[model samples]
Target: MNAGEEPGVVAMDVESTHMPTNSEEFVDAPNFDLETYISRYEGFSKIQRLQYIARRCPRLKNDAYRLAIKDLKEGCNTASYKEIMATVGDSLGPGYGYDAAWCEAEDRKAAAARERLELELNQFKTNLIKESIRMGYHELGRHHAARGDLAAAFKCFVRTRDYCTTGRHSAE
Candidate 1:
């Protein structure tokens, strides 16, 4: 009923004449001051306070909202909204924490880069040994072999092998 009208008369805002059936479905009146509106329900029941904030804020997954629910579940008031926001950076929406496939993809990318680097190193070593023998620097070639140059050590053992291939090296 209206505050000062007749007994059966009901109060209704200009835009919405049909009152909300469910308190959770209630939209805030136009130009409502949110903080003041929440404060008004503090002395009311917990369900009413929760409903008011839930309907008013409309950001259910926010860290501040989650902290408020936690506090409410623990039989305490929200205490401080800013403190709740400070404690949690991002709110986890209704799902598991990390993605296993994403981690695996990142690991595969790193492995591919490492493999490409190793292949390039092997190709460089093969080029160096061929050029050294071609220029007839045999001792310097042996020095390279001692330095763990893979191409010089494994592929350039020409004293043990048959005569060198013509185009590969003229080290006869």
Candidate 2:
């Protein structure tokens, strides 16, 4: 209780509270392995987790970004790749494995694959084959997951349950 203050109130000492601005202050695990750590996650989560780690740990930024770039090459998440590249542009310097040509090529390939899968799914639906329809939905879900579209992947995968013909299909 201080002068002119409420009887039940206490003045707060703002300076006594500590907040860390530097990432180095949070680096407690010096032996952290980014690869092993990221292996537990899949799809979009893997890239997101890596980006989070990169932002929080300056020492691991380069390694995290490098691994993220490698993962991006296998998926159709060009926007993520570009965003990550821009975030680490100054820190990573030039020629840090960013390829515009590869992005364009990968986008084309992904689009073509999506079109083919959708066409197959439509054919299966038209034929009224339960097994084929389920399989078609499963394949489309996988394709969407690989392209980093988690919402679409979840919807496609959920549709498979409606056409599941057996306990095994349901389990899968």
Candidate 3:
């Protein structure tokens, strides 16, 4: 122990204190099939994993971004979509299948879907049918997941547990 230093405390060097903000430097892998690899994941994780790969792997950046954009188009994550588009434009060039009109339309559609699902859930609650309420929450959870609202989806899914009346429902 150094003079006046705590017995258990060890002074950290500058290099040890320096933490990398980004990912470990990626080495391009030969025969790496991005499609087959990405197919292993599902739901929101697929897009996020693809984005992570795109950011880290220089060789696979374009391909990863392309796949991520395609997946994003199917969901309501406009912010991530736009962010990816901007990154692609900055790194490579513009016109990698970005559509502003689609983003706007998707926002509207998602809002409408959320409203409809919430209304249906409210109706199911008023009916006081446990099964219907459970199903309603499940559907709402699915809608929120498709809309990129994971927290709401998780809450809705968790709410289904309260209405579960059978082992099968609990398993589901």
Top-lDDT structure, candidate number = 2
Question: Roughly what TM-score does model 3 have, to 2 decimal places?
Answer: 0.80
User: What is the C-alpha RMSD, rounded to one decimal, of candidate 3?
Assistant: 3.7
Q: Which runs of model 1 end up more than 4 angstroms from their true locations?
A: 1-91, 94-96, 129-172
Q: Write the residue-wise lDDT of candidate 3 on 18-133 in tens digits.
A: 77685577868668899999999876899999988887788888888888888888778887888888777655456566798999999898889889989988999999999999
Per-residue alpha-carbon lDDT of candidate 1 for residues 24-136, written as tens digits (9 for 90 to 100): 45343445454544444432143345444554555532432553444333332222332333444345455322334544554465456445644554564577654433333
* Per-model tally of clashing residue pairs: 0, 0, 0
Runs in model 3 deviating more than 4 A are 1-23, 90-97
Shift in Å, residue 37, candidate 1: 36
Q: How does each model score on TM-score?
A: 0.21, 0.76, 0.80
In candidate 2, what are the lDDT values of residues 9-111, reduced to their tens digit?
7688899978877644445457998899999987689999998898778789888898888888777888788889778775665657568898899889989
Clashing pairs in 3: none
| Best TM-score among the predictions, by candidate number | 3
lDDT ranking from best to worst? 2, 3, 1
